[model samples]
Target chain A: MIQAVLTAEARTPGAARLHAALMELKYEFIRLMRTRAYSLSVLGFPLMFYLLFGIGQRSSAAAQYVIAGYSCFGLGSACLFGIGLGIAFERAQGWLELKWASPMPRLVYLAAKMAASATFALIVMGLLIGLGVTAGRAHVSLAQAAELAGILLVGSIPFTALGLLVALIAPPKAAAGIINLVYIPVSFASGFWMPMRMLPHWLQAAAPALPTYHLGRLALGVFGLASGKHALEHWLVLASCSVLMFAAAWITFVRSEAKSP
Target chain B: MSATAPAIPAAAPPAPLARLREVTKRYGQLAALDRFSLTLRRGEVTALLGPNGAGKTTAVRLLLGLTRPDAGAAEVLGRDPRSSAARTAIGAMLQVANAPDTLSVREQIELFRSYYPRPLATAELLNRTGLAALERQRFGTLSGGQKQRVLFALAICGDPEVVFLDEPTVGLDIQTRRQVWSEVRALAAAGKAVLLTTHYLEEADALAHRIVLIERGRVVRAGTPHEIKHSIAARRIRCRTRLTAAVLRELPTVTGVEADRDGVVIFAHEPEQVLREMLPLDETIGDLEVSAASLEDAFLALTHTS
Candidate 1:
């Protein structure tokens, strides 16, 4: 009876893994989309801010400049709120334990969150570009627009990595509050809303420490609004941040797992 | 060769579908499971019956691979419980304070079903769980019992051969609790190995083919419900009498006396003899009731001596 009762399925095929991955992605997207507050603000924040300050008696460079800055802002918010808060809340709810008990690969759970965050970041960039072009009077060529989208897509990775660590550390009930505490200050310090030249000297000097500032530089460079730093330098910083944070988060996770017993 | 005959040899009994062999799990200095061992076979439901902090949930966690045992082995289908192949054959409904409330019941079931190679159809899972009418309802909007059913749907939707349910009926009403018991019985009837942990003694009596009473990481008693119940061999006499437990203990054939909200319940091998002595001494006795001893009496008796 035991032998017959057991599911004698063969090894998981590649197709099953692919299907699992896709399903994980689909649900991750749906999970975030249903949270009206999360989806609406992550999408609307950049567009609304651009309307407020990116246009009206703006220079051609200024309109484009605000587009680049707010696009980076949107990407940062999406990754932080979506990936960070999402993981923290799920982990707190004991939902992660159920997933771990299932046959779903652990990597798929993480990869889905990263992919979903990137998707939201890209959507916000699209919306911001549309707003900039129509009412804000900002001009963006197809090549530049593609470059902007690429920047957002890749730029979300380091933030995703950072989000992992935050999720691990933040208390579940206060995850949202804690994320905002870090998110708002870093965006302002990184000059996501204003040009670096206009920021206080200390703030500008401190901007390089945050990864979002590097992403901000990459976004600004699409419209030739970046400072004198080479575009390669920004890539190096972002890439290094992604690797380092991922390693740190992985180590932190492993240590916590060990300590639980 | 024909001289020796096999008259009526039955087929060999099936091996355990899931087992924890001499497992010891420790958290800091306190051992959650000390040399613990358990098994589940197909077509039978096993209940890990214990009070809170009695290591019942810890044993469930070890079997689910949510936590590793400090010593010994946890196995399912001849593989480590943590392995993907083993997990694919297993379903679990853990004690979660909140499931993701945003998704509708159907959506949650569908998502869990996608994790397995062979899964029950959405309609079938819905039908089995009795959630057909509420499939469109979000988990957040469900009552406590309905949410528990949704979790149960997620657990069984994978058509798993072995299922682990950790305190599945906690906080549920008695009617809902009975509904869960019926579902558990169905799982056993369908020949799926089911292991559930519960503090509810009646739940263990109603659902489990075998019950293991754990205390402080040790199995104090493990037997069939009938075997355990019959072992006490006592009748329960309940009454609001002026006689205290200390006074009741002096009487003959009195095995145990427990003070509860109902009243002072006296357990004895001869209830009539105890009553003859008790009633005259306390003429004020009221709400007198007598019945056969139950599992709770067996528990109180076990605790009194142990």
Candidate 2:
């Protein structure tokens, strides 16, 4: 009886690989949808912040600025906590070991995770835009909204890389706390909560060094809400930071894999 | 007890599915596997039997390519274990693992099924593991034994040529253990090669076609269960006697003795000689019985001797 059931052969190797990747992606998406706390933290917090601060401001200019700033904040958390904390917990629970033993491609596993994070980033951006137009009454054209959304999505790369680096190095129990420490301070110093000029003089001076600051500047630039001397400089800083963070993450991952049983 | 080697299988053996040649894996000063060698043959179940920390896991890890052996060669399906092609043809259930808590049994099965070129149908998997009724139950909600069955289901879902089950039934109840044992037997009966690691002497006795007894990173003995049992010269003699267990142990031919409500059970190379001395000394002796030594007794003798 068992032999009869074991006789079914697989499809072509190429098709099987493709099917496996798609299955992984689909399950990851399902996990995100089912995890309410993750959804609320990634999507709810940004929406709440936008509603509170963006709508509280009567001026259309302040409302538009709030939209861009909170969008970066929302997406940044979505990537950093979503991937970084998620992987850390998975590693601690031995899920990574099981996955490694499987025939799934390494790239496919990472792609699924990153794709899930990006999907959340897009959802958060959409909610913020909807709130900005209706409740906040901000003046923004379709082109502006589309451009800002593109910038936010691209801007998520550096943060995701940073998250991965932290997750690879931190113990699972401490991952969430460590991310919080990094997230809160980086967001505040990067001027995600307000304009750089409004922050303390020293923090404003230090803003350009932070990757979130560059992301914020680019996001604000799309809406004509930020005044930076060179837009290309912010892009350059972000690209360089992305490379550095990814390299760090790769090094940490390799070292840990070698050390673990 | 006969010390003679058991007869080798009369039929020609199938080609090897996996092999480890003089594999030496080390962790600092401790050698996890020291010049160890093993072969997993097609259509046979090999049990790697040992106590905890005896390097069963290290050997499994080396063969799975989870870790490289410090020296020696390891191969699966005639290819390096690390190769994707080699891995695609193998399935494993590690000692420690868990599926996503949010997913149901059916969902997790479907997810793992997609990883292999050839995978069992979801319905077939559920039916085989006796999880069809619990297919919709969340993984987090299942009992320990049920969870283990789920892992077992995933291990064979890929129709792997060689399946590695490392302590698959550990911590399960007797009924669950028997259920798992039957499934393992089914795997072998289906012509799949299986390498199972277990400390349960009964488990190895029941499921393994051949047992490899390892100690301190070396294969101390390897043979069929009957052969291994026959290799031990000890015979067991049980009798209700007035003599204390300590006095029974004092007998020259007695290697070991245990006293309980029923009687003093004596283990000896020459039980007849021990009995010759015992019947005269204990006039209260009754219910005397003699039997061949079991695999547990054999394991104790083998591990203690070398």
Candidate 3:
């Protein structure tokens, strides 16, 4: 009976693989949604920030620019806290040990997290655009709204790669503190909270090097609010940041695996 | 305590479902597993009994492909442990296995179930682990024992042929620990190859077909619990008697005697002879009981010899 049961287990490998990947993705999103703190902060921060800073302004231009800027902020927060702190906590609890030991493909685990991060970013972008055209009364056409959503959704990837780097470098207990210390200040200087042109000259010079700045510029470009002549340069910087961060994360993870329980 | 149930004999000799052949893992200058070898066969529970830092966790990690051995091969069903085919047939309940606090018990099981081609039914999996009633509870809300039961449920949900349980009952209350032991027995009875690593000797004695005592990354002794007990060649005689330690010590083959709250405990290689001599001399003798030296005694003796 035992032999028969063991022999009967492996059916079509392709079907099992596909189903496993989908289940992983589905549950990851479900879990993320159920987390009130994550859902509230990822969605709440930008919504709250937009309401406080964007509404009741003298002209709709400030409202329009802040809407685009806050969307980028929402997108980065979702990736950094969701993927960054989530992985560090999981690794600390030895949860990754169990997942690694399982038969689920490594790619499936990574893809599920990336997809969840993107989906969270998408929801934030969608809500912000809905409010941008209505309550904020920020003159956003439907075509421009679609373009803004496209920028933020595609923008989640570069931030997700950065999140992986945070997971690798930060200790679990101190991960949130470390990410916030760097993320918030960088977000401020990168024009996530406001336009960089009004910032001190030193921060404006450093803004171009930061990935958040590149992403913010991309989002603002949707509303004809971007200043720089070369739009493609922003994509190039974000892409380079993603590649470098991913490579560093991979190397650190491989080296850490060599010295484990 | 009595062994839970009689051991089932495999039909002919079974091939090892997993094996670590002379695996040596090192951390800088310190070697975690020094040419260590272990084997797991179907329908058998092989307990890797050792103290902390005895390389027990390293052995499990090597078999699970969580870490590669520095010098030797780790294989499951004749395939590299890191290979997808090999891992598909295996399941592990690690020391600190956990999931997101927000996920419900049922959701965690569902996610793990999807990883296998032939996972156990949701109801059966819950029922077997006594987790059906609490299936909808969030993982963070469960008590410590309940959390452990959920981890156990996840380990076997995959219908795995080879299960690695590293310290499966650590930090659990006695009742919950026994429950886990019985479930582990059920897994073996169903013909799965179970490899358990634990520092608790009675746990091994209760559930294992074989106990391998490890120390300093080496197998100091390996045998059935009965065989391990016999190496000491001594029995403990506990009785409610008026006999003094000095008097009991004079009995034939009496190696040592000590006072107990109830009465006296006499250690002797030939317990029957000692009892016969003590019964006639002490008219108040009652509650006489003789049992072989425990595995703890065997382990200490072997560690000393090695």
**Predicted candidate 1 versus true structure: per-residue lDDT over A1-261, tens digit per residue:** 323223234425666666677778878898889989889899877877877887673677888888888888888888888888888888788788888888887789989888988898888778777877887778889999999998888888899999888998878788889888888989988878888888999998888998889888889899888868899999999999999999999898877765564
Residue A39, candidate 2: Cα error in Å is 1.2
Model 2 iRMS (Å) reads 2.1
Error of 1 at B80 (Å): 1.3
lDDT of 2 by residue, B49-137 (tens): 88777789888887787788889999998888889888888888986555667888998898888888768888999998899999999
Model 3 residue pairs with clashes: none
| TM-score, prediction 1 | 0.90
When candidate 1 is compared with the true two-chain complex, its DockQ is 0.45
User: Over the stretch B67-160, how does candidate 1's per-residue lDDT look in tens digits?
Assistant: 8888999998989988988999999998777877878898888778778989888999888778999999989999988988888988898889
* lDDT of candidates 1 onward, in order: 0.84, 0.83, 0.85
Worst 10 residues of 1 chain B by lDDT: B297-306
- What are the candidates' individual DockQ scores? 0.45, 0.52, 0.55
TM-score of 2: 0.89
For DockQ, the strongest prediction is 3
- lDDT value, residue A49 of candidate 3: 82
What docking class should model 3 receive? medium
